[model samples]
Target: MKLQVAIDRVSLGYAVNLAEKLDSYVDIVEFGTSIVKDYGLIEIGHHRPAFKHAELLLDLKTFDEGPYEFEKGFDAQADILTVMGAAGADTLAGVHKVAQNRGGDLFIDLMETGTDKIAQISGFTDAIYGIHHSHDAVAGFDAVATVADFHEQFPNVKRISVAGGIDLPTAERLAKQGIAESVIVGSKIIKTADPVAAAKKFMEVIK
Candidate 1:
């Protein structure tokens, strides 16, 4: 299991500093949707977070104009970029090709996508299928159980990742379950008094 720390709702400089501090400890550092929206790709591209150890993921959430968006994201130094599963097949395919050509990874965000949609896109063997719950949803998420169910439904679709209010305990559970390739934690790691300590705690548990 790999720990992916998401930095959001803060100034880009602070996010970059936090990412640099946690780079050696975490596997991936994500600039969440808020940051991408608040700061356009052109600005983010110019000031890409310089992470030496951890991979950088920008939640571009490309719903349309897949190729253009992905091309810019890669140009902006994103190691992995996301596209919604609900996007058209052509859109997904276009971005997938861009990622492949750029030698980067594509993360398909399966937020609010049904089984039929998942089945349709499961053929993208190299893409990481992210089981994400909406941040605005009122319900709680059972990360392990959801992973197990997704695995059962699509056994051939490897490289699973999950994100939605994951705490240390839930991260440990997901690690033990051994289904998800990576678990994403946002506020639990970023909103704490000591973010590095909190991140280290999560890494220890997952390890």
Candidate 2:
């Protein structure tokens, strides 16, 4: 299980600093949707903060105009980009093609999507299917249980990633469960007093 630390709701300068600090510690550093919406892709592309070790993921949460959004995200130098699972099949195909053509990865955000919808789009064998929980939801999430259920339902889907409010204990459990390819952590790692230490702790536990 890989550690993907998400940076969100912070200034671009601060996010860049955090990314630089965490580049070597984590496997992937994500610029959450807020970053893209607050500062457009053009700005991100121009800045192009260098990450020496970790890959960069832009959570575009693309709902439509897949080609345009994906092209811009890849141009901005994102190693991976996300599109909504609820998007139209054509839209999903568009972004998947862009990711393939650019030699990047596409993550389908499965927040609020049903099993039937997932089955319909499961043909994108190479894309990472992200079993995500909505950030705005009031309910809590059980990461392990969710991953188990998803795997049972869609056994053919080879790559799976999960994101919610994952803690160190949950991350460790996920690693042991051995289903999810990657686990995405946010405030638990980033909001702490010593983010590097927090991130390292997660890395240690997952290993």
Q: Write down the TM-score for model 1.
A: 0.98
lDDT by residue (21-117, candidate 2, tens digit) is: 9999999999999999999899888776788799999999999999999999999999999999999999999999999999999999999888899
**TM-scores of all models?**
0.98, 0.99
Per-model CA lDDT versus the true structure: 0.95, 0.94
Give lDDT tens digits, candidate 1, residues 21-59: 999999999999899999978888888877778999999
Compared with the true structure, the alpha-carbon lDDT of candidate 2 equals 0.94
Clashes of each: 0, 0
Off by over 4 Å in 2: none
